[model samples]
Target: MAKKKTTQDPALAQNRKARFNYAIEDTLEAGVVLTGTEIKSVRAGQITIGDGFVTINGGQAILTNVHIAPYENGNQFNVDPLRNRVLLLHKKQIVRLAVEAKEAGVTIVPLKVYLKHGFAKVLLGIGRGKKQYDKRQSIKKRDQERDLNRRFKN
Candidate 1:
């Protein structure tokens, strides 16, 4: 008998600017609570996490500002595109993340959203905002690396 092959869905959305704007320290995978229409929209690759952020309230984590466009056929079942969604995380993890986020200039940001085993998951990053000089340094470093790679490839 031959084994069957399975292909996974690609990432629905990603916050590429997160790394450029912040220095990421830690990361965690989390599940998101979504309505049927929202999930459908997400599966259709109509989500954006560019300005999304995570916050802990009452020992639970919530995702805000992540936009999931209304489903075309959802009609009245479609909810707000920018509504807050709950993030499912362990209690201990929630406490730890909350504490880390409360530290000076630290925050929890959504790095990306993807499907895992047919369920939606979020990649959360604990990061600190980078200063202007830091951003400049990173840009310089990236340029130098690119130049080195080009020289070696030629």
Candidate 2:
């Protein structure tokens, strides 16, 4: 009797530029409330979070600018791709995020979207926009690391 092994699902979509443009101080995982067609599109890897941001309003966390492409076979069931979607989070967590987001230069950015236990989840980052000079420093550090790795390989 061998034990079964469960495979982890990779992110359906990611915001690659979030780290480059923002200095993330904290991160949170949140469940997404998606309709049937939207979920199908997400599971098919037809989702994008490049420009997504999270905002709290009326005690609810909303995901905006994330796009879940319409399912090919969904037809009428497919809803608007850019519609604001609710994020499932505890009231206390929402309150904390909202408070943190109100700080000057601080905002919530969507980092990644993945599926776990048949539910879609988003990884959100609490970050501040990086200054132009800071971005240059990040690039310099990355280039130095790449050069070091190349030197070691050859």
Candidate 3:
């Protein structure tokens, strides 16, 4: 049988610092609710998930602090760039995330934004804040790995 073609969506924005700041324990994909202008801006790759985070309130998941630049042609229709947007997730999933988020030092952070099947989605990560010592250890381990790779390639 001929294999069906599968194409992954292109990433619009990513929070590169999240990995260095937190230890992610789990991840899930969630749909984003966006305005017309916001969607246009996201498709144009004018979005930033760096400071964005997810919160579960009243049994709903909401994404906050993400910046989606206004569409050049949107003019008066453009909404606030940092407005909180709703994230679509199952009731069970929302409850689970809420429980996890309630734990001390645990948070729901947006790792990346992308378009999938014509809809915008956010990669939500369940993470625990890393200590300063953990960050230093991670950096040191990464450097050692790089050095080992270089030595082996020679």
Candidate 4:
């Protein structure tokens, strides 16, 4: 029997804070629409999805607040860093997300950005914002786990 091979995405950037601020309920892999210069910049890891958010405007899904630094060699035709980039998804998927986003406390956030077989992809998550107490509880749980692991090791 042959083992199935899974390819690793060429991850150029990620928003580490997303892990701490929200409890992700569901995740959707999306294709990002980008220009040539933007693609080059992303490939070089000059990008930030830290402040980005997913929104549905005019019946289309858009990724806003992402910063893709200008390509060093792309002096004449560089794309703007904060432009609203469209996210490619099925019509049904978009409609489902749009409805879900209308609920209170549910928001969409970017989790990671990477290249999949030469094309740029964004991993979007449907997340619920965590309360301060919830965050503290999570931290405490993590600390307990670490302490248990240390004890077991010794």
Better of 1 and 4 by lDDT: 1
Q: How high is the CA lDDT of each candidate model? A: 0.94, 0.95, 0.92, 0.91
Task: Give lDDT tens digits, candidate 2, residues 7-121.
Answer: 5488889898999999999999999999999999999999989989999989999999988899999988999999999999999999999999999999899999999989999
How would you encode candidate 1's per-residue C-alpha lDDT over 22-141 as one tens digit per residue? 999999999999999999999999999999999999989999999999999999999999999999999999999989988999989999899988899999999999999999999999
Q: With candidate 1 superimposed using the best TM-score fit, by how many Å does residue 119's alpha carbon deviate from the native?
A: 0.4
RMSD values for the candidates in order, in angstroms, are 1.8, 1.5, 1.8, 2.1
Clashing residue pair totals per candidate (backbone < 3 A): 0, 0, 0, 0
Q: Model 4, 37-109: lDDT tens per residue?
A: 9998998899999999999988789999999999998998997789999999999989999999999999999
What lDDT tens digits, residue by residue, belong to model 3 across residues 1-154? 9988656577888898999999999999999999999999999999989888888878899999889999999999999999999999999999999999999999899998898878999999999999999999999999999999999999
In candidate 2, residue 13 scores what lDDT?
90
> Between which residue pairs do clashes occur in model 2?
none
- TM-score, per-candidate, Cα-based: 0.94, 0.96, 0.94, 0.92
lDDT of 1: 0.94
* Residue pairs in clash, model 1: none
Which stretches of model 4 miss by more than 4 angstroms?
1-6
- The TM-score leader among the candidates is 2
Please list the residue runs of candidate 1 whose C-alpha ends up more than 4 Å from where it truly belongs after superposition. Answer: 1-8
